[model samples]
Target: MTLADILASLFPAGHAVRVTDGLVSGDGPLGASRLAVVGIADRTALGVDGACTLSRHVLDVVQSGDRTPILVVVDSDSQRMSRRDELLGLNEYLAHLAKTLLLADAAGHPTLGLIYGHSAAGAFIATALATRVLAGLPGADPSVMDLPSVARVTKLPLETLQAMARDTPVFAPGLDNMVAAGAVHAVLDPDSPLGPQVEALIGQMGADDIRDRLGLERGGRPVAHTIAARVAQDAGGG
Candidate 1:
């Protein structure tokens, strides 16, 4: 499904949402408060400008001294690969965006990532990875790099990589694999109306992030929780 389709389904009939330059900001569900949604459409790459705009929105919510939930809509293939962006410290701008979201969360606002489509590389890091909870649509996939690109870089046969993906989700590129790896909290059903799910999640959001535990319980990820708990216990004993 397209980004517009998802938004329309989530915020239908006088939702008062606004989309400009591929950034969304306006009243959230039930007209409770302000929120932001950023997506990449028109094959647009999220560059420094988009990053700065999103960061500004988060800062605005923090300055208002109200808890505003920020929803990041992930649908981008990659960040804009431009020499100018790189020369002007694109990584730093991305870092600034991530830190701003963290500040917002600290200020009582919650950040959520809704993966509706292709999410990868630097774009995913700057947008979705910063959020507290990450939910994905059925077809959504978040990966460090697409398999074709990985194979090209590693000089491995494409068939070999594909076979490896079947055996190890670490090499896979799908929403289920992301859930298995503890990178995605859940894979939402595409057929169901998403509004209720989104609203319920927003109402139940808390500071405690449970993706690691969830992955272990669901048998998607095998050891992240174990290792993390062991480290936490060791640190506590020290």
Candidate 2:
């Protein structure tokens, strides 16, 4: 879906968001309230500049003191892979963006991510993965790393990785895999109106990060939650 289509689905009532240089910002109606939107579009590869721009917008929202719900819509490539970006400290910029989102959530502004198109790697992490809850639209493609890259890094054959992905949610690039792995909190039903589903997810939002528990409950990463809890308990932090 185009960004326009996504906005339409998300706010059937109406919206006033503007997309400039692939950066999305503005407000939209959400039931009886309003939501602040900060996102990327046009399949942007988040470089240092884009990351800085997005972080500023999120910080503006955080400083607004409204506690408005935030929706981050993502349609981006991985972080820009360029020597120039590296020299410009792209990692720091990306981290800043992710931290700003976390800050928004921490400041009582419920943050959610809606992945309507492809999102991968650092771009995904600094946006969708940083949200309090992430929802994927049908056919949305999300990847932490692509198979060929994983294959090259692990010295495994492409066919082997593909076969492994079929059996496990890890090492794959699909909405279902992400959902099973608990990275995606929900998958919006394509047949239903998106507005209600989004509202329901907003209503269900809590302050805790529960992806590890969801992974265990969904049988994806079955031991992750237990191990985390054990470590926390051992440290007297649970």
Candidate 3:
């Protein structure tokens, strides 16, 4: 079965989930059960418009006293590469998703993100904002262009680029780099005990109460705490 299929199985009766055109999308079944799954199709192909529309709709549901758990399956290597997307304000679309996730959290929906593929730029940001982030054994990687893209962007030779990636955490792919960067929270082999983990997360869901097990708290991601730190510093407390 595909990863999407496995995720769909995580939901039970009254859960809304389906795979259509390669996008795994769903919503709450009843009056608001903490359960929904959104899958990213070709992370690089997902643009701001689509992300904005989908994420906005999700937020609308959350505002209605329905504390549904939103499961995000992120696997994109980059945002849309078209100039049209930028002209149309891709940043705004991505920001909309961010706000929606924050709203979901504030409304008591436990937002869980699962990374089974590439993640980069907007894709990375969207998932990182989730309350919990889970990574597949091979899911963690550069989440962006390989050394070749970096070479082009940096004007460095491919050989030199690869060597640098090996030494620099920024360019490296795989689980270690993502983990060190605080992108992935927990690493699990496909064969590992996912059921129990899911249950544990479900039991821990709360209204605006986040558990710092994976991405936000313990995952060594600088950006995670950077916001809070800035706020605290601004408040003259830090």
Candidate 4:
């Protein structure tokens, strides 16, 4: 599904929206909150401008102190790579964006990210990963980096990396793989009515990162549970 489809699913008919430089800002479901949805459909990148825009909206929400829920709809395929972006300190901008989202969360605002398309690398971390809860549309692809990119960095043969991905979901780049590894909270079905599901989740919101536990329960990342338990036991002087 596209970002437009996701937006339509969340907002009612005739809901007013403001779109500027690829960032879409509007009132959320039933006028309960504000949403800043970021993405460029044809050209898949989140640049410094987009980052700043989202950061500003997040700061606005924090300042409002109404605990307005933040809805993130990410569809970027990559972070913008350019000499100008680097000269402008793109990393700092992304960090600012992340910090703003965290501040909103600290202010008691529930932040949720829905991946509607391809998301990877630094852009994914800056937007989707910053959320309190992250989910993906069934066809969404989420990754730290693509397998070919990883192979180039690690100096591994492409065939070997492809083989490894089949058995390991940790760094695999698909929604189902992320859900299995606890990277994505869930993969949403497009046919389902998203409004009621979102409202239900909003009602149950809490300040807990429970994906690791979920991974263990789903038999997808048992090592996370084991390591956490071991760390806790050692900390207790056991």
Top candidate (TM-score): 2
Rank candidates by lDDT, best first.
2, 1, 4, 3
Residue 62, candidate 3: Cα error in Å is: 1.2
Off by over 4 Å in 4: 31-43, 229-238
In the order shown, what is each candidate's alpha-carbon RMSD?
2.2, 1.4, 4.5, 2.3
Greater lDDT among 1 and 2 belongs to 2
Q: Per-model C-alpha lDDT, please? A: 0.76, 0.90, 0.61, 0.76
Residues 12-63, model 2: lDDT tens digits: 8789999998889998988888888989898989999999988988899889
Can you give the lDDT of residue 115 in candidate 4? Answer: 83
lDDT of 4 by residue, 72-173 (tens): 777776888988888999999988888887887788888878887788888888888888888778777788899999999999998999999898887577
Candidate 1 structure quality by residue, lDDT tens digits, 1-238: 7777877777776466567876665655645554556545443567888788878877877798777677778777677799988888888998998898788777777787888878788888887878888888877767878889889999999899998888776568788887777778766666787777776677777867787787787677778788989999999995
TM-score of 3: 0.73
Error of 2 at 147 (Å): 0.3
Candidate 3's residue-wise lDDT over 1-238, tens digit each?
2464455355434345665544557764422334576757554456776676568656766866766667777666566779998999887787877778877777777677777666666666755444444444454453545666677888988998778767664456666766665555556556644545655655655443232223344444435455755876989966
| Clashing residue pairs for model 2 | none
- In order of appearance, the predictions have TM-scores of 0.88, 0.95, 0.73, 0.89
User: Largest lDDT belongs to which candidate?
Assistant: 2
TM-score, candidate number 4: 0.89
